[model samples]
Target chain A: MKYAFYPGCSLEVNAAAYDLSVKAVAKTLGLELVEVDDWNCCGATEYFSQDELTACAVIARNLALVDPACGQITAPCAACFLNLKKVDRLMSEHPDLDQKINQALAAGGLKYRPGSVQVRHLLEVIYKDVGEEGVKARVKRPLTGLRVAAYYGCQVVRPFKDFDDPEQPTTMDEILKWLGAEVVDYPVKTHCCSGHMTQISEPEAFEMIRRLLYCAQQREADVIACACPMCQLNMDAYQGRVNGFFNTNFNLPILYFTQLLGVAFGLQPRELGFGKELVAAEPVIAAKVGAA
Target chain B: MSVTVKSKRFVDEVIEETPGGHRLRDCIQCGTCGGSCPSGAEMDYTPRKMIALVNAGRREEALSANTMWSCVSCYSCTSRCPHNIPVTDIMYTLKRMAIREGRVKDNDGPALARAFTHYVDKYGRSFEMGLATRYHLLNRPFAAMKMGGMGMAMFLRGRMAFTPSKIRNIGQLQAIINKARELGGAS
Candidate 1:
């Protein structure tokens, strides 16, 4: 299967591991990812609050840039995926806003029909497009003894229930199981990871982070696998602060779902962006998967 | 004496501005949004209560509250609302209204939002290191000092980029944005 990849800004920097693993896993699964040329940032969650129309216009610019040959574009970042899907849906549903957005786009010598390009998240592509049998066929190193908590965060499923159940998602769980890993049924799997709240309000953000970690620890998952860069960043980066604040000694390695998938497919850890995480996944993976 | 004749109701304005916000009027006061919210307690007014305030035409009270700023944009409330009121979109609309009206005070949410978009506007892509440094130094210097260790660790791991990445057609992107600002009447 082939897709137009929209790696978003996070993939270029903090979430480089996700980007690397996504490519490695896609190659292993025989999936082709052609990047849209000169794609800009999706404006994330910040732009909407500043100016609604401007936000939609900025996001639509990326959608307008998707090559006409590829009818589908995939974004690995949850925020980017949602923004792309959201803008498209809004334009199709409301024609006035669509015209306004198009007017804005016309400034840059671009015009987009709302439903021209289908927006998809990478997880959806892997799970539905590749299917279980396809994944099982390529698994050279099944994660036999490893326990993974599939953290869905919030954006992928919520506000738009296209792929999975909004409240109780199991796509990631099934993917991990197919890779021969134990999937923990953690309660806070679909809960918010505070997103940019960590920057705005630490007390509120840290509490949210602590709850996810505490639940994962309580469930005794070996590692938490995330589909969103923001989720992984907040959970992994602020874990030390969460421990310091709550007086709890909790250490959990947060990883992108693709990284683990790459490991199961016999890809090297370094190549999958394994060590980019603050909380090391190498020791844990080595302990369970035998020197991954 | 001159009287200010309001063109539209506060709730109506919000509904009109927010995408899929027409459902705001359909809210059943079921508090599902508040119940589903992860940071509902931190919010000055629960999302359900905010809707109630909007319905009651309590524009000043609703806009000045930290409820919208406290929102993490999780969309849990929007998804869980019994009437599907687009609660999160309403929150975004409220945030825009609050910022435009100069109602946001003693909150870092707006500051962070500004800092984040600042880079996106300038470079067409976000600069994590630049965003963190500028935001923290200007607003929370002490916190910046505290986060020095984490920042250093990120740099060592090659996860933080010192330089910003600019899109090839930055002028084209800016033209679209400027026209958007002009057409959208957003200052």
Candidate 2:
């Protein structure tokens, strides 16, 4: 199945692995992902709090260009999926607001109608369409003994309440099970990564970050699997700061869901967006395609 | 340098009182939840201690303690809990109840909570620096030392974007917030 794609801001800078691993696996699975041409930011979580209309305008401009008949717009990053879903949802519920947003977009020669696109997180498309039955067929080498903590972060499920149950989500679990990996059940999986707040509120963000790592350590999770760019970026990048702040030692590896999927897909580890991560998964992630 | 755990009256009430009172029931007592808490060391009552007090029913002392005010609501305890207890949410509910019951007496918290309520009421969202600075100023009158330093730094760094992100229609916002207040029975 082919889908138009949107990779939000983090993919470009902070979360290169998410962008890479997504493109790599989408190609391998024959799931054609045509990135919306010259796409801009989806406004992610930042803009909704800034100005709802302006945020809608920003996301609508991207949606306005998408070929709706294709039916699905898959985002590898959970934040992107959430942002796009927000615009799509708000546009449907509030026509006047949608009209205003479309008008703003028209200045840039873009036209958008509400509900023109279905925003699916990359994991959802991989799980629902690609299914365990489908994934099992492609699993040349199963990750037989790996233990994964599926971290959904906040935006994927909260507030909008789309895709999965907000309080307890299992999109990642269903996907992980297909890959022949043992998944750990941890309640903190959906907690906020503190995202951009790390820049604004270090102490608070540090506490949140530390708490997450501490929990992962306690659960004996081999690696933290994430579906959002911000979660991947912060969980991987901010570990150093967190360790520094509290004067502790930790080597928790953060993996983008697709990176782990790439491993599960029998793709070479190097092609799976491993090196781009801040908290290197190298030591823990035995990256050989046939070696679990 | 240290404090003992408080009575379990407020604690037990807190455990039994929440919408999902059973959340407090599944505490494996693994201490991971407490170990995972960032502010656990700072608080007189770690979440584990609070849960124990609640289960034991000396919750009034737990409720009245100053520790309830220190939770940052980062969702650390709840998320990390092996039991899936909504510890942070329990903290939120407790804070609400505590305020109603006059448990906490502080300038920083009530003022901060007031700003948080204003954000929810006005825009259906939260603004970090704006609320922080506002709370700080209100708490200190003219001497909000903590807030002033942080606010001035954030403003100069162009980090605190203060143009309120107004809801599309203030009227609609008022209606929704009013409805929420009605449902929640908030005056």
Candidate 3:
């Protein structure tokens, strides 16, 4: 269960909790992660709006950096996954794009050929490689009937088609179900979290958050599970703003996919870096295990 | 409270013109798109009815419907479309057509479009606060004035960056912009 991992910018800067839980839980599940050596930014999808070739090249340069022997690269950030997957698909199709990108890489004295590695979302590693039977076997704490709302956000399933069912993704649902949690049916699960829209339209972005939080609250989802770092920040850190905007009062904690996985596998909140989160996830965990 | 999404000729030309055209005929009539749409309830035509109307060749009515501008292009509908139609693409095309033909008389979507163009034109990329400020000024003037303190507070608190990342490749982007303008029939 060894993998080449790319934690990306968000993991390092904002979503350290997600990064912590991913590392801790990967070990808990016997996953051996080899973080990519000297990786650059994914440039996110918005970089394409400014310059398409440069965006592709920025991510492709990372693709060029992966160890040729490495079969797969796992990204914890959704935007990073999309960026990596886009360049991977592009490189797979047009060798010329690969050439130009590698030519850019040659500027740094590092060159990578495209299709050198497969880009995977962290959730895939949990469900496919980790296996439900293995997760069920490790569940010292079953999240029985917690009714967690699994939000996929847009980037994970778009353009490159990751392991998640692109249109109607079920990876999170399947994993949560295996962990003995009641996976609630949510329509906006695969919808955009308006990634980086927090930068542009605060009101509109707040409304987007409001809609998701409202729906999740209405369904009484014990917590929302996310794989994207920006989504985690918005849904967790901004839930209070949305509640204030709409005059509703609820904390509505957001959990990274790995954090919940860690908890279900008997990892403690403090070890997984749970309490440090902007939105408290301990109550949800406590309620799940009846420890509260 | 009415939107002037008029001009049947404009609608037909747009639907028959782009790669996104004829997607009208592919509508499965599921309202999942509209139901999930954040601004669905505020529109003259939900994404569902907008597709139906276009498919029915009720071009003038569809064009004039108020649903053209509220989409945030989140790819929710396109991502979920069982019919495989890109609802956002269609909406994008419609918005372009509406502006070019002066079909949409409302300032909402057109204002957002103008704000986006202003962003790309100046910085070669979008700055959220810049767009938010411009969008506020254009569409919600009063909100812009009242929300200045709020925006500035966020700015000081490091929640927003005033400087947008600009590229030296603006000329190159203009070429792609030319290509899209042609594809979108904007020119």
Which candidate model has the greater TM-score, 1 or 3? 1
Give the docking tier of candidate 1: high
Candidates ranked, most accurate by lDDT first? 1, 3, 2
TM-score of chain B of each: 0.95, 0.74, 0.75
* Best-first order by DockQ: 1, 3, 2
Q: What DockQ do the predictions score, one after another?
A: 0.88, 0.04, 0.09
lDDT of each residue in A1-292, candidate 3, tens digit only? 7788888765653566788899998888898888876555565544443334555655665566576677889998887887788677766766665666555555545566666688898888888998888888888888886779999887777634647666688988898888888888887787666565554456767887887887888888889999888888788766666677879876778888888888788887766767656567787678666662
Q: How many residue pairs clash (N, CA or C atoms closer than 3 angstroms) in each of the candidate models, in the order given? A: 0, 15, 5
Report lDDT (Cα) of residue A157, candidate 3.
Answer: 76
Query: lDDT tens string, model 2, A1-292?
Result: 8899877545654466677788888887888998776565554443333234554665666687788767779888766776688678867866766666666665555677787688888877888888877777777667777888888877677545546776688989878878888888878887767665554345766777777788888888888898876676576666776787799787888988888878878787677766666566766667422453
Q: Once model 3 is optimally superposed onto the true structure by TM-score, how far is the C-alpha of residue A265 displaced, in angstroms?
A: 1.6
Candidate 1: give its CA RMSD in angstroms: 1.3
In candidate 1 chain B, what residue range of length 10 has the lowest lDDT sum? B18-27
Model 1 complex DockQ against the native: 0.88
User: Candidate 1 or 3, higher lDDT?
Assistant: 1
Candidate 2 local Cα displacement, residue A230, angstroms: 0.5
Off by over 4 Å in 1: B1-6
The runs of at least 3 residues in candidate 2 whose Cα sits more than 4 Å from the true structure, single-residue gaps closed, are A287-292, B1-187
